[model samples]
Target chain A: MQRRLFLQGMLGVVAATRLPASTLLPLMLNGCQREPLLPGTLLSACDDARGNHFVASIQPDGSLGFQIPVPLRAHDSCASKQRDRALFFARRPGRQIYVVDLHERLLIQTIDAEPGRHFYGHGVISADGQWLFTTEQIYATGQGMIGVYRMSQPIRRETEFSSHGMDPHQLQWLSDGETLVIANGGILTHPDQNRENLNPDTMQPALTYVRVRDGALLESHQPPHHQMSLHHLDVSAQDQVVVGVQHQGALTDAVALVGSHRRGSDMQWWMADELTQLRMQQYTASVAVDANGGQAVVSCPRGNGIAVWDMQTGQLINMLDIADAAGVRRQPQQSGWVGTNGAGALVRIDSSGTATALQTLRQYPLRWDNHATLI
Target chain B: MKPRFVRKSRYEKKNRYVRKKMQLLLLIVALLSLAACNDDMTPGQRWLATTTEQIRQGYQQLSAQTRAQQQMADAFCQQPDAQGLQTMQAAWRESMASWQHMQWLRMGPIAQDNDDWKLQFWPDKKNILQRKMQDILEGSEPVSADSLVHASVVVQGFSAQELLLFDPQFATVEKFAGRQCDLLRASTTLTARVGQKLADAWQDETWLKRWVAPTATQAGLTPAHVRNGEILDALLAQIERIKNDKLGEPMGLKTRDKKPNGYFAESWRSENSLANLQNNLLAVQQLIRPAQGYGLFQYLKDSQQQALADEMVIKLDNAQQALQQIHPPLTSAVTDAAQQPALQNAHRALGELATFCKQKLAPALGLTLGFNSNDGD
Candidate 1:
């Protein structure tokens, strides 16, 4: 019930009630101004009409909250355990991570990658919020590294561990919290090459599970096809992982691009109807499991559709036509999902296969980026 | 040397000249600003609006032809004669021709609910259609249009009807004793119903609004830019399919070490594979330079790339002409060595056209095709 309340609160909380900047000046001087938990329901890296990059926040009601400008475009973001702040990481080849203090509605810190490392544009905070783990790669060798940071006074980088694969992109927390499940995309790319896949023919992608406390490799499994690069995923309360694949081969290669794996089991791929497969187009942007873990939703931005699957049976339940679908996440107060598209529309997705525009989403001249995070 | 009165007049004349110049400058600025904020459709936008209308009309034709086909099938089933069989096949071909003309390059109401596939399912490499159709014919229950609503896509639409009408084993009126007529009437009825649904779907104004204006301005995105790129992408993509799947695959150019396999060809049972390929290219030609209104051809001309537009249309013309030069019954044509060069020329023309679209047309329009839609994470 409390979690539901938290989700509902994210949708709207009267942004007009925010204290004026003048009233908070004295508190800032004292260096002790802590406000509410992250002030918005949805957080994403967006670009404005003028092409300026920003780490933006929007309420459940689709009202704009904060737009913290950043130097480079960022990717997926994860809220801190305390919910007081959130971190947005720059995409590969970028070494900066922007930290936004939700209460102050300001970008409080910019964390730089260790001298020789760069981020893969994804990260997750521990359940207790003690540590922040990020996907990164050693620049010179193209080796994947998991950069661990102790969430201390200055948020310093403590150490790192090998990702056990190449081009690790997005990671999620298992039910145990300390166990991180990562999608090792396995495509070798150099930062200087401008996002080129240097080893497509030889790439080996995998879904891997690693222990954060000791950096131990618990389990690892490669995709059925060597060219099936696993990129983004989300884990449920049952530790069931749903991952989205980006195939680096012919478009007509009819391989399943979304699948699930529970530890110690073979991966179960979700197959859509043949027509739906045509719409999926072999690329997926995000994978989100609903609050109940009974359903999995994947946004196929390339195909401009969203597909939902029955978690237990791994069968497709519904396909929603959403043009340029960017990200999907479960609603704060219910079983359905909220999806954002590239056309600047927010759509509410019901498990019954009906997709409707979120009527209250205030129109903005902004394109929602590839991923969305909840505060 | 002039008098004081003459000097004053000269100064007045200079003042008048300066005022006139300033007014002309102001007028030019006002006109430029209007151009910047012009609500008038760009050449690309005009093409999209025109194409949308064209798509609606095409769907209407499909609905009408399919309805006529359903009626013709019922008439033939009641009479069961050779003449009736010929008439029924002609109606089926016309309906299929209408469908081939649609060539939806992207999403719309027809694409939203799997409606398009319910109307026609093709490229059956595994012969799922025949297997399912035979199973249905061998079943206990009497097949009807309502029953097919929930049936597998394999036994539905034009492909199933083709098996019933054209395949030698199923084509005879004597086969009606085994419920062949029932399957034909049911499949044709279902086809007509789905076609009508597609036509109805295209009438929604809300859908049209979303289809045309697709992206946010943060990327300098506009309706014309998005729709025009998709049209070009779809045209190029379908032509590639025709060159490869429809023509090359059956020719064994990409499979079985160059041994021609006629069974792989679409509409092989009906022996209309070559005709289908021609219709597909005709649809591509219509989109590139429609008979009426501003098409992609006009858009190209506005961008000062008329030569590129002409090259694409010319290439498509060459492809269709080459395809037409081949013999009937694509199933046998693939095995006839004499027809191989024509097939190869047609295939080469299609490949070159697709390359021109991707390389030349895209840049000339100041658009990058499939940036967000096809970009992988």
Candidate 2:
């Protein structure tokens, strides 16, 4: 009789608390009983930031792979190989792109981009491998733009696209095949002064989509919420989009929506877009969509956690605190990473929510602008 | 059948609920522990605390005395004066005494009973000399040349003072007294040998012979090639006197010579009386620039000992510059040599090197004057 009463009391407390699932699911995922479906797996990681150029592969069993030399200096990041040709970017001297032969891993040609122009540096290649898109920040006038480079031509032709907002950082490709999505990271500037000139009072954040069938912008989408500067974005196999936002401190910004597109007409923002105001201090630096597009993960480096959202439920499912989430990446055998920033690390999260770290990447301590791309 | 079935169902339901609650509590505890254990820590602090203190202590235990001795040597080298030279010689003796003792300590009994005589004579060398004295007491005087040769091994480890103090044939008063020119010559040779050994340690041999001759007794003699002719006559004539003496003469043999004033002076002047001999002996005594390790006679190898001299000169110049930077510079009166722009700069630099060697490196290395000097005397 006494044990029954005790059990009843516990149930009563849980029901009355109405505690959020997000506050509890993280505990379950990070606990020992939650066995990783693919434990100790590895992946390839590379940091093409500095003059350091090397590739590290993590095996399926979590063993570190030998470092393979990639003949490029300060590779910002790498892109998927197109017809045995891979593309990488470097910053020393000036911002430029190099096309490399994947088998030989050697640069065969270089295309110089805008010199003396400050580039925010994250870029992605088109699925057909005919286009390369990168972000550019013009410090002189505090204006930012998207650079669309045509790689199909004998000489790479660059077409400048103005960022819907300032300080664009990364871009993603939509399943529609004709649309290119971008994160216009809202960062203002004053070169005449220092970074101290960032006007938090007058910053706008937006996520843009451009219809580019033959390389051009079409339509776009914005959360009608407030200015939550989206910094990085990724797409899942199921076509769900994950966006990380650096919100300008305001009560309305915190309520930005994140979810999957159920249909062209039913595609609406997450309902959480109305809870409270968002602050820049709560901004995140990384975000990725799960392989199946059922989940989205956003990393708050300062929070040391990856905030997970369930697209199916339109609910914030979990937040995995990995101590150093800034260095974390999605792996096939695990849901989150525990690594360092600017360190080369490749991670993949599979359909079963298993993260597999491809390999440990060497910190390419180069002297230039750097970014990463999916290979 | 109905009552039994109902009772069993109730028990199963209670067990299931209890198990669920227990599982939930365990899960919560596990989560809390995981969160606690994953706390972050700052890096580069592990090796900071103890290693830094150890490095500081290592630096503090340096030998300052040897550095001071180097300074004294530099001073002697620069001044080439009687007192500076004597001080250096004394310091050399002190260093040799300590070094020999240190070797004795380091070798312990391993250096004893090594029938190889050379090796055995290292630590118990004093005993070897004592043995020789014992033999002498048993009517074995002058210790045989073979035994003397064996004793030389012990002598190799002797300090300068020990070499001078160890008198075999009661020659201490005769050979080292005011009239004992042979001991004076021997002393001069030992002083030079100390400097030579220092050079040898530095792997410099070209100038070693000039500093220390093969025979310690032969080093202080006048150059065998010096001629007494018109030049000698002119020098002697200026004195308005005549003297007589022979190198191979007996102790009392003498010839008298008279001056124009009819004053008759003794034929052989006392060892203390011959001004030239005394002056030469004093010069040789004052020239005892004893060095240690690879540091002695370091100046001699310089394109004229240019390396060592330049080191001394440069350091002194820096020190002078440093001194000048002081609000009120060091109150050193500028000498005539220092008045010349170049010489002045050189002297100032040399002085700084001298002070640095003496105050810093000497004690740092635990090196002193003749760490292993006094051999072959």
Candidate 3:
């Protein structure tokens, strides 16, 4: 009964958020039953306008299911198929992962950085959901390390691998599940300085493919420009990887901030027209590939727009405008992707250049973080 | 058929009626609360609305100046006298001042279609304007509004006109003989059209509404705090460009050997670089503390940071005075050691203003620098 009452209070907050399904959600996800809450279509780490952080679940029908307050702001999240669990990793320089028990609809456990190690705020679960690989760096040395953990022993870091470069972030597994592709942002940072690029001129950002078993660097490729920080990436079923770049140099630099890569070939640079490039402002927040593997969506938050690419042709197919646009993920039931912005907007961006407003919680005013997890 | 079922059905109908009444009451209460929320605008909200209006006014000034600029160009083309050239130059200066003031707006319609570049192309390190102008002049193709519609942006804007009207090689009465006149008319016509379109985009009060209470579709009305963060970024970026690109690079501050390059200075041919810089500063000053509006100054005062706001004013004034004191063209000043101190002082003043805005004013207003746009992975 106490748990039910707690859930009822949570439902109240979610309803007050007034997501797209504002009218029906208060009654739909009332959280009064003893049964575990069903998984939602999307899971994200969100922040409200008043500076409150939450691990939020967006229901399949496009309504707010639940939002649990967290002490720290999380970056990216991943769900485990082995059990009803989802882990939200704290952003860079952060040390903990909030483990949410889907069945109990509660934070089940917290994973801390082992001593001097801090997470880069992104990780990928194994295909069977048994093993977890997280991007980490030695806080003092600024060396990239991929921390591995077994789902059964969730709280402990079992092993580590060299990420082949510094500032490893946003890794994804290939279809074989034994290979991990890491976007080594190539900039060194200390927790004390707080995200300042300590080695801007010398940083060597790369796309590194590693053998998960032995932590061997299988292959690595660098961006055309050394200052381009390859930060976030998404892997398709066909082993195609799409990476987003954040240039540490001038915003007007003509560097392509989006690239696609195959294992044995050179990276393919994708760019928009000159005007589009100027609006993109040389920065991209997140990159997401659709389920079918023929299209990719990259969120250009600085540009206040999102660009969809035809993966087959390496061409920009559509550019949809959204204010502070970020955290785009493939639509579960369609080829389009859902995006969120800082102004509490959930937008549906289709490949055909159609953008549909799915939900807006402007008054409750949540700024969804850069990346969203399709649960 | 059962007696209990017949009684339950009647009870259900009565319950339904009561539920409908409750919903109606709830909706009315909800709407009243929303109305109450909208009654008094927060200081930040008021500032945004005022800023929106200021933006519209700024664009209007730009359009008017460009239209006048086109007229002057046409007048010069018809007569081609020294006095006519001077008048046309004055009009171009007026248009540039207004354009510089509004150049910091890198969003909405101006940036959406890159009309800003169409109005003025800067940092032309490769001398594309001179090359393109010579090419067009040498070519037999007719220059007109329709012909120049799809012309290279380098030749379609202020930079090309500046070169043609100011450079000694091109700015002569003899140079305005035929083709150059056609080029000037064509370019100014294009610029006026672009400026008018921008002004028209913001002519209505709907932009203000969209800016503050925007629907998710049209990309306006970001939370005031977040929008302020970007605005602050735009201000700082403009300052950086002015300090770094406009002055620092030409002054040899950015070079390894510290050798001044007069040719690199923008508007060096006409020696109007300092004048342009001054106009940009004046525009920034107006944006911060308009004569009558709830801008950054009033917003700061509302937030009880009057002292900080006053300091910003003092810094801006100091920079403006220092720059004005440099009597020579920025090209000469960049190379003259005698003018170095004044340039350094003005640069320092700009740095202080930017620092104060980013550190003191931003925090005072609850805006954080290097948020998502800067720090996002």
True contacts kept of each: 0.17, 0.00, 0.10
TM-score of every candidate's chain A:
0.89, 0.62, 0.87
Arrange candidates, best lDDT first. Answer: 3, 1, 2
Q: Pick the candidate with the highest TM-score.
A: 3
User: What DockQ would candidate 2 receive versus the native complex?
Assistant: 0.00
Q: Which ten residues in a row have the lowest lDDT in candidate 2 chain B?
A: B368-377
* Residue clash pairs of candidate 1: A11-A60
Q: What local distance difference test score does each model get? A: 0.76, 0.37, 0.76
| Model 2: per-residue Cα lDDT over A166-258, one tens digit each | 766667777876677677656575434433326555566656666654544454455454455566777766556666655544322234534
lDDT over C-alpha atoms for residue B61 of model 2: 19
Model 3: colliding residue pairs? none
Instruction: Compute the lDDT for candidate 2.
Output: 0.37
Which lDDT tens digits does candidate 1 get at residues A1-375? Answer: 453344344353434236476544544564543443323378888765344678988764455668888998887888777666789999777899999876677898899999888998899888888999999999788889999998875678999998889999999888877789999999988888777788877898988889987889999998888999999998887889999998876554668888899999999887787667756767998889988788888998867688778888888877777667787877654666666765455666666433333321333455567788876
The regions of model 1 sitting more than 4 angstroms off are A1-170, A183-207, A212-231, A245-284, A290-295, A301-303, A308-318, A329-375, B1-45, B79-86, B203-264, B302-348, B358-377
Candidate 3, residues B267-342, lDDT tens digits: the string is 7777888887887888788778888767788878888888988988898898788878776788878778888898
lDDT of 3 by residue, A249-307 (tens): 75556789899999999999998876677677788998989888988989887787888
TM-score of each: 0.68, 0.37, 0.75
